[model samples]
Target: MKKTAYFIIGLSLLFSLLHAQDFTYFEKEKNIWLQVYSNQLKAQALDSDIKALERSIKEAGTKKKIELNQLLQLQTSKKKILDELPQSFDTMLEKITVESVKDINLIEYLFTSQKGKFNIQTQRLKILKQEFDDAVAFLTKELATTESQENRDFFKEYQLKKALDFFENASGLLENKEEVLKRTKQSYMSELEAYKQTQLPIHIIKIAILFLIFLLFNLLKYFITKKIDNEDRLFRIKRVLNITFFLLILLMLIIFNISNIVYAATLIGVIAAAITISMKEYLQSMATWFHLSFGNSLKVGDRILIQTNNNQIIGEVINISLFQVTLYESINNTTALDLKRSGRTVFIPNNFFVTNYVYNYTHDRMKTIYDLLEFKIPFTCDTKRVEDLVTEVTLEATEKYMEIALKQFSSLRKRYDMRSREFRPRIHFIPDTKSSCFILYIWYAAPYHQIMELKSQLSQKIVKKLQENEIEFCSN
Candidate 1:
């Protein structure tokens, strides 16, 4: 009876040990199977996502389609990874089950390798998610700022919708990937926290410094230019300061942020090339404006005559800008017809300065130009008498202008080696044999704006003097 009881107890103990060993093996197999099942589900979801992205690409606009294709490539790559992971896990799981291996260290090693790969995937997904979030935010901002209903509708239907869809899909995938990583005894949140600790503060400092620099420069610009009274000079100075400010900021940004010189140079070169190509005409105009501003070739309130397409435009400069020069058309000796079009504004492109000739009537503030008065008289008339009368009338009409002109000419002479000339009124006569008459020419100095008025005064006086002297004028 004692031998029988001992045998039964030993048999029970042996059975219990066998059951415990089997249970341990089953638990490990079950966990791996669960991982396999989870990965398969993820792979199917990624495949569906890739297919959906391909379809969306077809329905999207040109730019949107390109973005969707990129998304599709990313999704396909992820599915490939998922597809590969399941095969690897299955092979390891199969080996464990078929070989009935009591130790599954090889499976653990495979899982460890897979965790590293999944971590890489997680990082990629994080970057993709950030890009999508930025795209969606940008689209939202554009939609809000767009005043046109047509534009708003287009953005909502196309850009915003596609961005939102991409964001949603990426977010779902990221969550699943993070969940997988958690099960592998790795947490993405810890890595993220480490990155924030290591890098985020530095970025924050850079941004804060950039903002402060921008503010300081703006304040300095305002303070320096606020006291200036000359509007034209102030505007030109402001433009120069603005260009300097932009270059300084750009240089500082490159210096502060870009560690790689090769990359920085390439980026700068590319940006410069794009701007030069896209804004060729405008840049030319701006460069010409710089020349005009510093060279003293043009200014506001100066009377100028520009010849364009065989037509003459005489006006007073009202404004000079980077792109164009504005003029207020006025009556002048060069273009008398401008009297009817007086007060009208004319805009000449700044780049026109390169190809066209501009005649500044009031150059160097001289404000005076020589004007001619011509009339015909019979050839039989006394030449001496006509000359004397014409000269007398011109001198009387332009008495005040002669002194001012002489002073201006003196100043101009100091600056340039000018040819000497008689500053006072002069009279000349040319016999017109075809018409049996002599042309009496009177030249006088007059203000640019008052040329017509001065001419009228001299003409009335000269004609009266000729009539009083019985000098018969030729009808032709």
Candidate 2:
């Protein structure tokens, strides 16, 4: 009976020892897994930092470039170390399971192997932490010294402030990552399980759905536009499709976080108010554009004259956009000397139409205009003959446009109540007392753009006729 009791006691002790060893093995396995996850997180963060540093290097000056390059190298090396960490936690666990728990030698070997790996990981982390601390201290000292020094250079001060902000942010990021790493090291199995649960496949599906929707919208636009032949209609359709797609995207993004609807609405309202206040003039211009588009007061290819305080501008409307009207400066009978400025593009703000008068010469499709030509003649030289000669020459020059002008006037009379006016050419005599001569004025109907050339032709014809008829002009 005594021997049996002693044997039973010994067996119980052995079982207890085995159970304790098993528990220890499980804890070590969990610790290795935690470290592996921590390394992965650190590597992701380092990747983000590396990309940011590379971008900063592109824009940084010579001195800053050197410092950033060094920091970049340090971050790259740290990431490489993190990436090389053993990620085969499952394999290691499987290996432990394949071996018998009663095999003490096997357990010892596995434990030592895992412990060595853990120690290497801890050592690497310590080295990286020390480097981060050194970088933080150096940056903080540099920032404080830079802030204390002052100069009169605005650009230099701005650059210094930017650099200080970069350093401060980097320091804050490093400190935050270090705190996270420390917290993760102290975390338990519950926290690890929670992290695994949070990385659900649904999140990936949501992202894929968003990309698919974007592609579908683009395809729809492409197919719809491909069938349309009219450029104007296509442009309008494209604009509408783009706006619709943008609104749809916003709606989807909002739906994705419907729990934060109140916050989103508030943010949107604030942004809208700010934009309205800051872009008041631009908003007005855009509103005016809608009116110009639907209203008949303005259209592309119309001749318009805008009078300002200092001078008048006459141009042909080439394009009408959302915020401005584009015009091609054209030489007119009134502005004949502005040849140098002709054909140059002019941009007029759409808001300019609200307070100013725009004179459209071709209003109601009136294509012909009355142009005047003036020449001086002696007060005593066959006034009646000169008048008849001028009238005859003017009538011949304007013969082609006379019928068109008459028809346009007839059409206008039907559309609007107006007085009858002569469409034929006419000659008038004005006495210039200061110049001691009579100014012969000849008025003729001509196309809006052809006025300058037609006037030149008429002048030559009139001078030739006068010379042939021995008509003398008064010379100063």
Candidate 3:
């Protein structure tokens, strides 16, 4: 039993060591790539060098063999220096810097410099120096232009200088990044060493699967676009689908915890948080959409007064979405005939309504009543006689529209325990406080839209009918 336990423990320890080794190697490779990505200046210089070298090689016709021999000798010398690189990566880096400086001196021998070429080279060097100065200025501005002196000191003394030193060293090492890349590629190609037998199939399969996934995604997008004409909805669906698929792919990669899924997830989460924070306005609009979907407060077709810009707009609700609530714009409580003006739609942010007062005129028609018209006449006009005259006149004028009003009023009143008598138009004669006369109050059933017209017509007809009946007018 003791021997078996020892064997198992040894195997576990070996597996753990192998796992750590794999992680460290992978991390180092990734970090190297990241460093290369950060050194854009070096990359550009390398590209320029490669182009120049290529042109020189192409131009050298008769001297091609001699030029090639010189280049080979220089390369062999650089390789010998590289071979003597220190075991310590840091020390190796220092040696690499020294070797690069030596290589720069050797470049003069490889390329013949004319008198004018020296001037051009001097100008180019001057430009490069100016670029470094500009970089320093930008970095200093970012670091030093801080509210706190302590923070500025930290950046100026440590971070800024560290970054500057890194850039400077990288710039020196990358005398020609393109040439280095070419040499590396040439070496790799010459060796052409295949990956381990077990790893080759896995890598091939991964590439094939990635290709298939891309094809499938495009095909689905094509079909989905055809089905959904709404660009916003399509974009949302596509974004969600992409995220889901990406997660699935990541999960598959991390099934054995061999890949950097955790790192990827952390990066994605940070990026997502940044995006959400940046797009706060858009997110607020989305919150308003959620309010519209579940909230029983506002609905389409309801007449509401939205107070924004210190302006009140009472209109019928036309459209409701996440970002905006569109209302068919109203003028003087009426929808315009022309769709552009009165019928214009106002797209207001959903959250704005919550912050401000949203007057829903059509919340429940039962709780509200239409306009109540009350008219005053002299007491001498005979209270009972006047009521009869005015009531008859109102009934005659409103005969066509009264039925509809009564129907609406009846339907509205059913919800409340409102007094049954409040639904009808009643003429009342009350004592006038002013001008020594009693006021004959004529109450009538009316729609809000035609209140002005109805009142004017009723008044005129009552006066005419009274005069024809030889009724005496009361004096103030």
Which residue pairs clash within candidate 1? none
Q: On TM-score, who's better, 2 or 3?
A: 2
lDDT of 2 at 310: 58
Kindly report which residue stretches of model 3 are placed more than 4 angstroms away from their true locations once superposed: 1-277, 331-341, 364-369, 372-421, 426-476
Candidate 3 structure quality by residue, lDDT tens digits, 1-476: 54554455445435434433332321232333223323332333334433444544454555554664465465445445534433222332332211112111112323532324434544544454455455545545544554246445442345445555665665553355334534544443333233233444666677687778778888988899899999999999998778677766655545523465775677667756975898777778788788877876788777777766665676778889877888876654223322234656778887676578887755544222244444455545666776677678877877656566556557657776765444345676667677566666565666544555666677788878878877755655
Against the reference, the lDDT scores of all candidates come to 0.68, 0.69, 0.56
Best candidate, TM-score-wise?
1
List runs of model 2 lying over 4 Å from the truth: 1-277, 333-335, 338-341
Residue 141 displacement in candidate 3 (angstroms): 49
Ranking by lDDT: 2, 1, 3
lDDT of 2: 0.69
Give the TM-score (vs. native) of candidate 2.
0.44
Q: Considering summed lDDT, which 10 consecutive residues are worst modelled in model 3?
A: 97-106
Which pairs of residues collide in candidate 2? Answer: none
**Per-residue accuracy of model 1 over 171-219 as CA lDDT, tens digit each:** 5554554465455434434444554577666666877888997898788
Q: What's the number of clashes in each of the models? A: 0, 0, 4
